[model samples]
Target chain A: TQLLEQSPQFLSIQEGENLTVYCNSSSVFSSLQWYRQEPGEGPVLLVTVVTGGEVKKLKRLTFQFGDARKDSSLHITAAQTGDTGLYLCAGERAGGFKTIFGAGTRLFVKA
Target chain B: SAVISQKPSRDICQRGTSLTIQCQVDSQVTMMFWYRQQPGQSLTLIATANQGSEATYESGFVIDKFPISRPNLTFSTLTVSNMSPEDSSIYLCSVHGGQGNTGELFFGEGSRLTVL
Candidate 1:
């Protein structure tokens, strides 16, 4: 079974601070996606990175996929209180039939 | 964008009782997914529901404990049988539908179950 590991499982930061979260794995994935979820709700799609070394920006969030397709990262610039949520990374295998998810990083941006 | 809705947003049931959660999507989707999230944990795929086909469950899950049904392309149901305290968790329904069928997955609000 393939697994994705997320680092810094818990993060607490003040508003306007910058934070970065990492997702790594030994298995190579054909595509990777990032999602943010709040309490009592389902995850919301942030972005999907399909190419190695590719970067996608969504407002203040910047996401990058590793060149080897074994890792990914999400960087938030000038974080706001609204950014406080659980961030998850999911990867799709080459066959597109299976997918694995990371443990997720919980960000607490204080106002 | 596909809007997925799940019924019984929150419920408290006895340990031996069973609960069935319903998922409805705004649009017809080819793939419907069910996931479970333990308290303070990540999401785990329970099974994949395909229209007119038996659900494919993951390694740790079984058809007896979690039976899934997909009556059509836009609707599915999951039933948790003989529930225990360990079965208490948030059940979420998701779909693989987006612009041009991208890899992105959309999720429902989720059903929170408490087995006491």
Candidate 2:
């Protein structure tokens, strides 16, 4: 079975602080996606990285797919109270329709 | 992107009872997915519902405990039978964004179930 391990299960930071969450796995994936979920809501897609070493930015968030497609990272710059949520990374294996998700990183940004 | 609506946004059920969550998509989709999530945790795919066919459940999940029905392209239902305290979790329904194999998924707000 393929599993994605996420680091820093919980994080609490003050406003304007920078934080990085990492997702690692031993198996390669065809594509990786990052999602943010707020309380009482389902996850929303932040970005999708399909190529190795790909980097995509969405405002204050930067997502990176590793060169081997076995890992990914999300970096938040100057995080604010609005950035507090659960961040999840999901990967799709080659030739498979199943998407495996990481345990998730709960980020709390205080204003 | 697809819009999904789930019924019974939140419910409180007693042990040994059953609850069925309904999902409706605005647009027709070939496949709809059911996921289970504990509070503050990531999603776990329970099964994949396809119209006119039996649902495909993931490992560790059985059809007997969670029966799924996809009568058409735009609707599906998942029933949690003989519920227990451990069955308390949020159930989400989702569909692909029509971007092919590696496309993103759009999910409903989810049905939060609390079993006593």
Looking at model 1, residue A104 earns an lDDT score of: 93
lDDT of 1 at A20: 96
Number of the top-ranking candidate, with TM-score as the measure: 2
In model 1 chain B, the worst 10-residue window by lDDT is B96-105
Off by over 4 Å in 2: B101-103
**Candidate 2, residues B1-116: lDDT per residue as tens digits?**
88999998999999999999999999999999999998777899999999999999998999999999999999999999999999999999999877563658889999999999
* Residue A77 lDDT in candidate 2: 98
How well is each residue in B1-116 modelled by candidate 1, as lDDT tens digits?
A: 79999999999999999999999999998889999999999999999999988999998999999999999888999999999999999999999857654667899999999999
lDDT of 2 at B45: 98
